[model samples]
Target: MRRRKLSPEERDLWSRVAATTQAIHPVRPAPPDDLPAPQSTPKQKPPPPKPDLRDFRIGQSAPGFVLRQDLAPPLSERLAAGPVRMDRKAHQKMTRGRLEPEGRIDLHGMTLAQAHPELIRFILNAQSAGKRLVLVITGKGKRGLDEGPIPQRQGALRHQVPHWLHLPPLAAAVLQVTPAHQKHGGSGAYYVYMRRNR
Candidate 1:
């Protein structure tokens, strides 16, 4: 194959530019054959020091393993930890089952769609009728077949009711909502204290 020859001006420009540049990777010298060949095996870090197992028994936990704890507190603890929005003394009595609920609504066996509007209507009517406290019974949810990747929490309604009570429509009429006392249904129901209708 014939090579294209550079013009005189082009050849001059190439020589000038090439003179200013340094080789990024200069050619390396060949190693002597008499010396041992360089090992191809890459240097590896020492395996993480084996955990001390001298005293470990067959069933004992491995050293440095921590007993896992739940990241979030239980639902009851979270509710009790919230700041008091109602009168302190009355709040105390209400939680202790001393204040009786004037009206009760059992919302068990209903889907979320079926239960929400009913709850709103019940709370609104109770407030207008001069009720002070009411019971919202969202039975402790059943353990259904958990077929999804994420683990499901028991009591869908139980967890959702409190969140619903805090939203605008119900939040206006509701003064406080707490898990019910044992006689009133324990964690299965809630004591919903109503604000004055006016």
Candidate 2:
């Protein structure tokens, strides 16, 4: 306990009382070369390179994969954008196959629980047998084994038989579903048109 060395007039009176007090730990002044040097919030663009899947395997085939857009819009362009409901000159001769399906119903190999009760018993017996233009084939769909990650729109009865001919037990015996002309089965058949059994 022997410390005592300050005599130069007490080291100029302790450097004038430590430059008039104040420095609980302050030595940080070195940033004046014309300001502006603290901007670090622009590094968030490194998240778009995750499609390598380590030499990817599951059913390969993505070499130049280019789909550019299609999360739905080809069930024959959603049944040719609906809204024709029937009889515009017999729906233009049943979509140009020149009207002639007085009842067809193939539904391919069934299985949406046997094609929704055989398409609600063939559109309620083709509108109680008064048919007007049946057809309803549903084929174009076999590309299977996609292995998930969403992308399966091939033909579960060509998109659920035009959504079970518009639900409610065949939307009251249909009356106009369209999409069938390429000689009656283009986007895989579907010219329902029935309602008329009063």
Which ten residues in a row are the worst by lDDT in model 2?
A: 64-73
Estimated TM-score for each candidate: 0.65, 0.26
Number of backbone-clashing residue pairs for each candidate, in the order shown: 1, 0
67-114: candidate 2 lDDT, tens digit per residue: 344566677776777788765887887788887888788878777888
Question: Native-vs-model 1 lDDT?
Answer: 0.89
Residue pairs that clash (backbone atoms under 3 angstroms), model 1: 141-155
- Model 2: what TM-score? 0.26
What digit string (tens of lDDT, one per residue) describes model 1 on residues 140-163? 989766555566678889989999
